[model samples]
Target: MNFHRTEVRHRAVARLRAGAKNADVAREFDIPLGTISYWRHMDRAKRGECPGAHDPKCPRCDGRELDSAAYSYLLALYLGDGHIIQYSAHRVPSLMITCDDAWPGLMNACETAMRKVFPDNSVCRVRKTGCHNVKVYSKHLWCMFPQHGEGKKHERSLVLEPWQQQIVDAHPWQFIRGLIHSDGCRITNWTTRRVGGERKRYEYPRYFFTNTSTDIIQLCTDTLDRVGVEWKPARQKSRKAENISVARKASVALMDQHIGPKY
Candidate 1:
């Protein structure tokens, strides 16, 4: 489970709690009905309808306390609409973010793609279940912007690609662990060249980086800006005796820019 999945679960739970019917919610949100049911029951338990906490049980043996049938009931409730429940592909995380605006369209695309492949609704349903074992990938991703740029823009829903997973997997702790390392110094004022060729000065501490490429530094800057943190690049020390190429520096700079500055 990653941040995006966590967000999906939370949204699902919230929607269910808001009196949305499981099927309607599932259909509307492109989530399986069983997920809706599970969250709904969990909501009830949270409100104290069930004295015992929900727990994982053995898949085998129905007559016992935590039997398959009992678990199935919970599973069915969570999924709603009698859809068979499957284990989540990964662990669920505590925090997640996703593009809400594009998800519905993506779901429709998935429905169409799946229908094309399976033709029969029953076959599609079966594939939906079995597809759990197969990796279903996202189609595309984009950012959402306010009309005329009046309001804050949010990241548009982007489909995750299988290769994106590899890129993500390449950096194990990029999300959890801070990438840029730097020292902090308090500043009463800052100065930089303005686009209009005038020197502009503002009040803030300047952030510096060492042995970091320009791209990564920019990424650090953008990330900080998003979070309302002020940042600016400082001069880099020359190690030119070793004859570093401009292209190498440029590439490093790009990657670093995306990575952004950090402490």
Candidate 2:
């Protein structure tokens, strides 16, 4: 395969930093073993450290303590509309959460969550085709959130680790709120009814969450159940995705008490 020098170097650096053997990296990247050795030497020399002799407590690269609320929010954003990308040219992986350009509040929440997760890293906003994005770069971020992977989320098996599940269990409301804010919406729904002798329209508020991943939908429903908010599942018009609706007056009221509506 034809590969750019920069791309090869980037891959080499990432693998080395992740503690892969030179032979393993060469085999994985399909590069010459000697070339891999040379890259490793150059990388270590640039850092002025011998191979495998780097400090584990390097302030910039060490993992941070997980903030359950912040991480749960970030996780929902990720499962809903966020993706992680690692390019051969970039030193650190990037976590990006894309929101509708019109929803500035949602965008701000995403940025805040990322900053809370990686307090030392800078979060930046970028304008994309029809949405705005909040992004942060950190080498250790992916270790904490290992859900990052290839292919569409629905096509993959989504499961939370034991530690992550514990966080969700302790802060299910925050988790549900994040999921709802990202993939769900609150709207005023109406129905026409006959009262006394005249036909009248009655309006009620409801929440609807739609997503392509069944596992994610199940997670939302399970969390709502745990929080005592009632909901019902429905198939989306496309048939490719599914949704859950919380429309019962009492149920909506309960959700309002817990998740509420994202501003």
* Candidate lDDT values, in order: 0.34, 0.82
| Poorest lDDT segment (10 consecutive residues) of candidate 2 | 54-63
- Which segments of candidate 2 are over 4 A away from where they belong? 1-63
Candidate 1 off by > 4 Å: 1-4, 51-86, 89-263
Q: Give the TM-score of candidate 1.
A: 0.21
Q: How well is each residue in 1-263 modelled by candidate 2, as lDDT tens digits?
A: 33457866897879988999999998888888877887787678568787554332222245436677888888888889888887654346788888888777888888888888777677898988888888987767567777777898999988898888888998888788788888899999899999999999999999999998989988998898898888898657878879899998898988898777777
Q: How close is each model in CA RMSD to the real structure?
A: 20.6, 7.3
TM-score of each: 0.21, 0.78
Model 1 gets an lDDT of 0.34
Look at candidate 1 and tell me the lDDT of residue 17. 76
